[model samples]
Target: MSELKTIDARNTFCPGPLMELITYMKQASVGDTLELLSTDEGSAGDVPEWINKVGHDLISNEKIDGVWHVKVRKAK
Candidate 1:
């Protein structure tokens, strides 16, 4: 199993969480899985859009206890 890079952006809003994800994604290797935790409602949509725009794969997105847990695989 591959290790997952975790980005805890809880309590952060919008671009903050998205920017953090992008920053980490840049450092992550291709095929690496990333887990993002965000409390921002916009991230539910923004993150996925950015992921697709950047050609990453979104594995899962679920909200648990008001936190959005998004898993993504780096494609490029």
Candidate 2:
């Protein structure tokens, strides 16, 4: 069974949150799920863009209480 991991990148800006997600993604197994939490508004769009560019599965992307939650599944 695939596992879900949370990567908190709250309070950080643009590339910071995206970079953190990429780092965790590298170490994640195929089919694993990663949920990224970020206070940066750009992450709502940026994270999903990156996920698509890299050929990953985007489970969901939403904002709650001013925080962005982007969920991705490792597809490669």
Candidate 3:
């Protein structure tokens, strides 16, 4: 099973959640996973795009209880 790390960016706004994920990714080892929770709609797509652009794996991007849950795996 993949590890799940949740980054709470609710009410923070766009790019905030994404930036948090990026920061955490820098310290994570390859194969580690992060589950990002954000209220910012921009993260629905932006997060995954960042994962791809930076060579990470997006496990999923789903809505759970009105929050966007972005699942990512460290690929590099």
Candidate 3, residues 50-74: lDDT per residue as tens digits? 8888888888899988899888999
TM-score of each: 0.91, 0.93, 0.87
User: Clash number for every model?
Assistant: 0, 0, 0
lDDT of each candidate versus the true structure: 0.90, 0.91, 0.84
- Best by the TM-score measure: 2
- Tell me which of candidates 1 and 2 scores higher on lDDT: 2
Model 3 TM-score relative to the real fold: 0.87
Instruction: Name the 10 consecutive residues with the lowest summed lDDT in model 2.
Output: 8-17
Error of 3 at 42 (Å): 0.4
lDDT of 2 by residue, 1-76 (tens): 7999999999866558999999999999999999999998778887898899989999999889998889999999
Pairs of residues clashing in candidate 1: none
Q: Number of clashing pairs, model 1?
A: 0
After TM-score superposition, what is the CA distance of residue 16 in candidate 3 from its true location, in Å?
Answer: 0.8
